[model samples]
Target: MTLHATAVPFKDGASTLFPGGLPARGGVGLKPEHFREIIESKPDIGFFEVHAENYMVDGGPFHHYLGRIRADYPLSIHGVGLSIGGESALDRQHLDRLAALIARYRPQSFSEHLAWSSHGDLFLNDLLPAPYNARTLDLVCGHIDQTQEHLRCRMLLENPATYVEFAASTMAETDFMAEVLRRTGCGLLLDVNNVYVSCINRGRDPNAWLDACFASIPLSSIAEIHLAGFAQDYDSSGASLLIDSHGSPVARAVWELYRRAIGRTGPLATLLERDNDIPPFQALLAEVSMAEKIMYADAPRALSGEVCA
Candidate 1:
C-alpha cells in the first residue's frame, strides 16, 4: 500500500525517491532548456516529469541536475519506448534499463503510452496506433502485466491521439482500456488533449467521448492527467487533422475538457508537455499556474474558510 502525507504517498517503501507521491497539482515537463533555471529557482510547481528514454545513460549533466531537483520536488518518469501495444513480447534489455533508472531515481510515478512503436526488432521512432480488438486487447494486457510485475510497481498507461481508426476494431477505446486496467491492475494517465485531438480528427464529439471514457473507467483508476498543445493542419481531403505535436500553448478547448476531467476525477497529478519549439521556462510555468488555478477552484474549502493547504 502507498502512504500519504499532505500530498499523496509514494509506493509503500519508496521513501527515498519521493517522500510522498506527486502532489495532485500542476507540473511541467523537465526540459533541458529549463534545467538550470529550474534548479536555481526551485519553482512552486508540484512535480516534474522526464522522458525515461533520455536518461538511460551512465552519468552526465542530466543526472547531475536531476539529482539536485529530485531532492527538493516530486519526480515522474514517463517512458515513450515501451511499445506496450506491440505483438512482439516486451524487450528484456529495455526493461532492464528502465528498472535501473527507477531504482536510481525512485520517481513518485512511472507511465508509458498505450500505442506500439516496435515490431519484430525494428523499432519505430514514433508512437503508432493499434486496432482495438480481442487479440490486441489480450496482447496489451499481457504487456502491462509483464511491465508491472517486472518493475515491482504499478504503471499508468496513456491514451493515444490517433489520426485514423481501424474498421476491424471491435471495441471502443474506453472499454478496451478499462478492461486492461481491470485485468492487470494498472492505472491511467488521462491525456485530455489527446481526447480532443482524436475526437476532432475522427469527426466524433469530444464531450461525448470524454463522458463515455470517464463513465467506463473507475475514477480512482486515473493516476495522472496530461495537457499539451497540438499542431493544426489539414489532411489530403482538406479535413482538419490535428497532430499531437507538443509545440504550442494548450488549446482553449482542451483546457475546458481538462476542467471537466478534473471535476469528475478530482485532483490528480497534472502535467504540461512541451516537446518542441521550447520556450522560456517562465512561459511554461505560467501555463502551470493556469492549471493550478483550475485545480484550486471547485476544490473543497477548509472549515476555517481557507482552502486545503
Candidate 2:
C-alpha cells in the first residue's frame, strides 16, 4: 500500500492544492441518529465529519447512510485508533482498511490524534498521551510519514486532551507538535477544547498555551479547528480537573478560546464534536451556527458572505 509522497499535495498554511477542500465554516460529526434527518432536512452545514473506524466495514447501514449524506456535503474523516505515538509499529491491516475507506469517500480532510491508544497486541480504548522528547518525536514523525505514504494523502494531527504529563518529557507540547509538523509536512487539527481542558487540569492558563501555539505553529499548518464541551471535576488535591468529554454544548470559556483561535487562523474549517449524550440534530446544528457566528465575528472580512446563516 505504499504510495509516492507526491501523490497527494501536502497542505500548508492557507495555501491548498486539494480542490474542494473542507470549507472554512462550521460542521458537526455525522451521527447515525441524525443521518436520516440530515439527508431529508438538508441542514445548512458546511461539512460533516465521521470517525474513520466506524465506517471501515465493507458494507452496512453506516455506509448506506454515510454514502447518501456525503453526496451533498464535504466530509472529514477523523481517526481515533491509529496510535501514532504507540511504542509498537502501526497495525498494517488497520492502516490498509483506513486507506480503503479514504479512497472510497475521497474526503476533503483526514486526521488522527497525536496520542496513542494501543500497546503491543492489546488495543486500549482511550487516547493516551506521549512524552514530549526526541525519541517520542521521532517515533511520531515516522508513523505519520508511513501513514501519508500509504494513504497517499496528507493527514492532520490532533493535539491530545490529557489529564497528566509525562515526567520524562524534555519538550513542551507546542514545540513537539510544531517539530512533528515540520518533519512530516502534515496539517494540524487544533482541538481548542483539548487545549482548554489540558491546561485547566494542569494548572496552566489556556490563553497562555494558545499564545505559545500561535507563536510556534505555523498558521497555515492548522487545517482545521475542533470545539467540544468538557466535563468539570476536582482532583484529589482539590484543584480543578477538566475532562475532554465530548458531551453537552460548547462551554462559554471554550467558545471564547475558539473566538481567539479563529482570529489567528483566519476562519479555518471548524467542527463541533459530540460523542456522548447525543442530542437532536437541530441542537447540534445550533451549536454549528454559533461556531459560524463566532468565526464570522472574529474574521468578518475573511468570512464575509462565506458563512451560511
Candidate 3:
C-alpha cells in the first residue's frame, strides 16, 4: 500500500509540499484570475492549492504563472480526476501524467477525492458518489495502493460532498474511509465544509460524522482539512441537497465546524477551496487571514495553561 518509491519517512515534516508544516493557518485555492495578483501582492499566506488536472495539459498560461507562483509559495496538488471509487481500475495514463506533474512540481502535498470521477472509462468532471459496499471499498483500496506506488508519494484521500445515498450502501462513509486508510496506510484529507454540506443534504448529523471521523479514523493519518462553499439543489420530490461546487467562500457555520475539527487535529493543513466564480487573489487571501485568526485564536488561552472553555 506504500505509494512512495523513494524512502520517505512518514515522520514529521517529511514532504516538501508539507515542508513549512500543516498550517494552523490556511490559504485559498490558486486560481488563474488571482495568479498575477498573488505574485505581485505576495500575500502572507501558508500555501496555495491547484487542481492537478488544470495543469496536466501542456503549453498554456496556467503553467506559466503556476511555475512562477510555485517558486514563492508551497503548493498542494488536489486532484478530482482519479476516480478512486469507480468500478474499473485506475486510469493508468492519468496516473502517469499526475505522477509526472508531481515529480516536476515537487508539491508540498497531493490529494484526491474519495468519490469517483469516471465510470467504465467515461470521465465525469464531477465527483460521483459510490455505494459503500465491499466491492467499492476493495476497488478504492486497490486504486489507492496503486496510486501510491505509481506516484511514489503518500496520497491523502478526501471525503466527498455527496447529494444522494445509494440504497445499496452497507457501511457508513467514515467506516469506508477508515477501511481504505487501514488497508493502504494513506492519509486522510478531512473536509469540514463537505461534512456540513453533506449533512445538510443527506439529513445526517454533522456532529455525528465528525465524531466518527475523530474516533474511528487515524488522527495520525490526517494530513489536511478543507473548507469550501456549497449550493443547494432541489429534487423532484421537494427535497434539497447541498452540492460541493466550491464556487463561494466558506460559510460562517462551516467555519465554526472547522474550529471544532481543528480542536481535534491541531494545526492540520487547511485550505479555503473556491473552484468556481474565482475572485481576486487578495480577496481570497483576506479569507485566509480570517481563518488564520480563528486557527490561532485559542493559542494565547491554551498557552496560559488554562483549558479552552
Scored by TM-score, the top model is 2
TM-score order of candidates, top first: 2, 1, 3
**Model 2: how far residue 250 lies from native, Å:** 0.7
For model 1, the stretches where C-alpha displacement exceeds 4 angstroms are 1-11, 14-20, 301-309
How many clashing pairs does model 1 include? 3
Higher-lDDT candidate of 1 and 2:
2
TM value for model 2 = 0.93
Please report the candidate that would top lDDT against the real structure.
Answer: 2
Error (Å) of candidate 1 at residue 34 is 0.8
Q: Looking at model 1, which ten-residue stretch has the lowest summed lDDT?
A: 1-10
Residue 188 alpha-carbon offset, candidate 2, angstroms: 0.6
TM-score of each: 0.92, 0.93, 0.89
Task: State the lDDT of candidate 3 residue by residue for 1-309, as single tens digits.
Answer: 223232333433544344544445687788887877777888888888899988988777898898898888788898989988888778899999998888778887889988887878688788888899898888888888888878777888999888889999999998888888888878889999889988888888898899888888766678888888888778778887777888888888898888887776666567988878887666677778777777667445443444444
lDDT order of candidates, top first: 2, 1, 3
Give RMSD to native, each candidate.
Answer: 4.3, 4.7, 4.2
Name the runs in model 2 displaced over 4 angstroms. Answer: 1-18, 304-309
